[model samples]
Target: MASLNVYSALVVLFFTRAAAMATKENDQIIKDNNCETKMGLPCVLEAFTSIFKTGTISSKCCGELVGFGKVCHTTLVKRTLENPLFKDLSPARIIVKSIQTWNICLALIDSPSPSA
Candidate 1:
């Protein structure tokens, strides 16, 4: 029926608009995170390699982690959890230990120093 076609067209238009909005939103988040200029894909990949091996996150990488807003942080965590590489690497255990270590580093940076 014509009404059914109209409904289908509206649904498609709504979804297309939604997808464009989502893309723009994600672009903004990426910009806020300085992903292109600061957190390049190659750099993050390299840092993660070292992190997984020695459980030592470089200061640069740590800064990037702390820079992320809560939503971005949770999104990254979820994606990392879902990655097959993490499963092979036993990511949960590594993340627990790493969090403990990174916390110390993060705490120092987060704290304000006394001014003379």
Candidate 2:
């Protein structure tokens, strides 16, 4: 029974990591599509937004989220700070979590995907 409990915990840990990675890739996709439309890539963002569930960004989206790791990060930190979410979150902790999530998706995308 103890062995089974340990195995279950490990599996849970693995899936949690998997989900985090998914979020990261999704973020990149969103950022990419956003840039295209912003720069006047005709019909790309419109086609993406019309179907995207998050109603935010696309799966093929790829690009550096502007102002990330710099002023934007600091800006979000301040915003999340004043907002109720970060009263306990703290800026550093939230950033660490964001990195971890991004890494997860990157790992999947980098891996030997079955389709390949």
Candidate 3:
């Protein structure tokens, strides 16, 4: 009976440690994909400001915007953008526009060349 108890305790300890490691890894993944770090406030501000002047989005910005959408999803993006820091910005509009632009860019890339 004592040996059985010891084995049970060891199993519990191993599972608990495994669970903690899994939780840590999940948290790290969330943190890495968060909008503040991935998309960034500065980048948004710059992109919005530049759109009027250039009428273009760089490939880097396009990728980051797409990634933000993929990571945060629509509801989370809306909630996060409701923060006071983003009160003046329209998250829905930006997200929609970004998606549209990304789609257009993707289509252009996938299109066959005139010569081909």
Best by lDDT: 1
Steric clashes per prediction: 0, 3, 0
TM-score of 2: 0.31
Please provide, for model 2 over 1-115, each residue's C-alpha lDDT reduced to its tens digit, 9 standing for 90 to 100: 9999999999999987975665555555546544333322333343223222123322233123221223333333333344554356555765654444334434544567477
Clashing pairs in 3: none
1 against 2, candidate with superior lDDT: 1
Candidate 3 C-alpha lDDT tens digits along 1-116: 99999999999999979756755655555566664565766556544544312356566665555666544433344444444676677656667754565575456545665884
Q: What is the C-alpha lDDT profile of model 1 across 1-116, one tens digit per residue?
A: 99999999999999979756765666667667655455556546644554466545556666665654344543344445555666677767656654664574477558776799
Q: Give Cα-based local distance difference scores for all models.
A: 0.59, 0.43, 0.57
Best by TM-score: 1
Runs in model 3 lying further than 4 Å from the true structure: 1-54, 59-69, 72-83, 113-116
lDDT: worst 10-residue window of model 1: 68-77
Each prediction's RMSD to truth: 8.2, 15.9, 12.2
Evaluate model 1: give its lDDT. 0.59
Instruction: For model 3, give the RMSD to the true fold.
Output: 12.2
